[model samples]
Target: MPETPKKLTIATRASRLALWQAEHVRDRLQELYPLCEVGLLTMTTRGDQILDRSLSKVGGKGLFVKELETALLDGRADLAVHSLKDVPVDLHSPFALSVVLERDDPRDAFVSNGYGSMDELPAGAVVGTSSLRREAQIRQRHPGLVVQPLRGNLDTRLGKLDRGDYAAIILAAAGLRRLGLEARIRGYLPVEQSLPAAGQGALGIEVLEARADMHAWLAPLADPATTACALAERAVSRVLGGSCQVPLAAYAQVQGGTLAVDALVAEPDGSVIIRARAAGPVADAAALGERVAQDLLAKGARPILDRLSMPDASA
Candidate 1:
């Protein structure tokens, strides 16, 4: 008789986008292993609850991910599926990013009711965005507009837009597409306009380090291109000591056997922007990213980052 297949339970946030990503993984796993049992352990994270203030104020990247991680640590779930951007570049022991799916559009989307694009919006127009990266980029490009802190999930943010609260808003093009809201996007900001966050538009599967037995089960789901790009982008963040509080952005693209990376660090007020770029063989993606990060730091990124707010939850 054949041995029974192992059951897999994935932990995830209750947000529509998070659910979609988890369900996607579940469906893929089912297809790969027709006899395996897959389940979802959905929970609300602290980031989802504390919506009054900026995510930076409450807790940076971990706020969105801690609970799901806890579920995995406590053995309640076999995996934690997350948006790669939300996962911290510096991970703790016993927890490892075991798999990464192919990336989606790694650009920021401009969504509005009447405006066709953010460039067309008149001066003093209010733009909603939760990310410091988007705010800084918008402020630098369109100083005439008002950048407001917009928090909450996709539906809530869209609700605010529909309610006439913001003239325009910026969001990850990937999320919009994943939710079937791609039609809501009016335009996509070019990479030069808004460098995406590290690991944006990708999915990461987190599993305990001790679960070496499961590696083969998940390895087939990994996308080499996305993994290389994500590593390069995350290397920039790691080398720069960046978190949500700091207005930092990094994007990496892989072509053939080479990887090109772009990174930026800015003051929250959007007064200063330091940017850098690098390209090298894709096999050296992490090294390429670190080189760009060092290039930017040598160009005065550290002082600006020091003056910026550090939102460490433990502190």
Candidate 2:
């Protein structure tokens, strides 16, 4: 008798959005390799357990991805699914991003109780979000509104707004759509008004660098356009050293075979914002990001980067 084929285990966070991403990957893999079995292994990260402090104040985006990477390294899981934005800019040598799924909306969404859009929010209204990028953009546009730190899974955060703990909350539209919660979003923020973080709205498959077989299996799922755009956004963060405390923002989009990127650096209080944009062939996506970053630095991004690297006085 022939031996049984081994099942592929995909590790993911237990959040609804994370599960949706994993399921999407599973379906795609099944279609590609009909004989292979796909299984899901859910694990909680430190970030999920500790919700009292904002992500930047605690540990930044790494909080959401570190544990899953560890699982991959330890051979406990065959692959890990991650939100591309939550991934660190500089990955360790032991692991490689095996596949980048097709991207989603790549824009931020504003969900409020009764407001039609961000502009409709009353003056002094409170908006809840855990991202410095979102908060900074909000403050830049509507200084009169109050932005407060909020932390939780999607449902938990939405519940806070429903219970009147906050008048509105900002979230990634891709996440909401994946989990069938799109109805909660009052409006999607345009990239011109609110630039998204690097690699936002994309999902990544992480695997051991030495696992050539795994890469071969996953390679077919990758989307070159999405990969190009994500790399460009990540380049800016990698050049900046991935400081979680810094008020940094980056967005990359593909248009007419060209990739256009916008990056920003700002004081935490939204006081001194510096923005730069660049456009070039999609093949030069990474270079475009670097060019934008250099422009931002020339416009005074260096001092803000320096201050963010310093030890916190409050600590």
- Which candidate has the top score in lDDT? 1
Model 2, span 1-315: residue lDDT tens: 123335788999999888989999999888977888999989999889889987777777777888888888888889999999888888888988888889999999989988889898889999998787777778988899999989999989999999998889999999999988898888999998778888889999999999888887888899999999998899998887656687788898888898988989877667778899999999998888888888888998888888786778114
Global lDDT scores for all candidate models: 0.90, 0.86
State the TM-score for model 2.
0.96
lDDT of 1 at 94: 80
Error of 2 at 59 (Å): 1.4
Candidate 2 Cα outliers beyond 4 Å, as residue runs = 1-5, 313-315
lDDT per residue for candidate 1 within 150-250, as digits (tens), equals 99999999999999999999999999999999999999999899989999899999998788766678888999999999989999999988888898999
Error of 2 at 92 (Å): 0.9
lDDT of 1: 0.90
Clashing pairs in 1: none
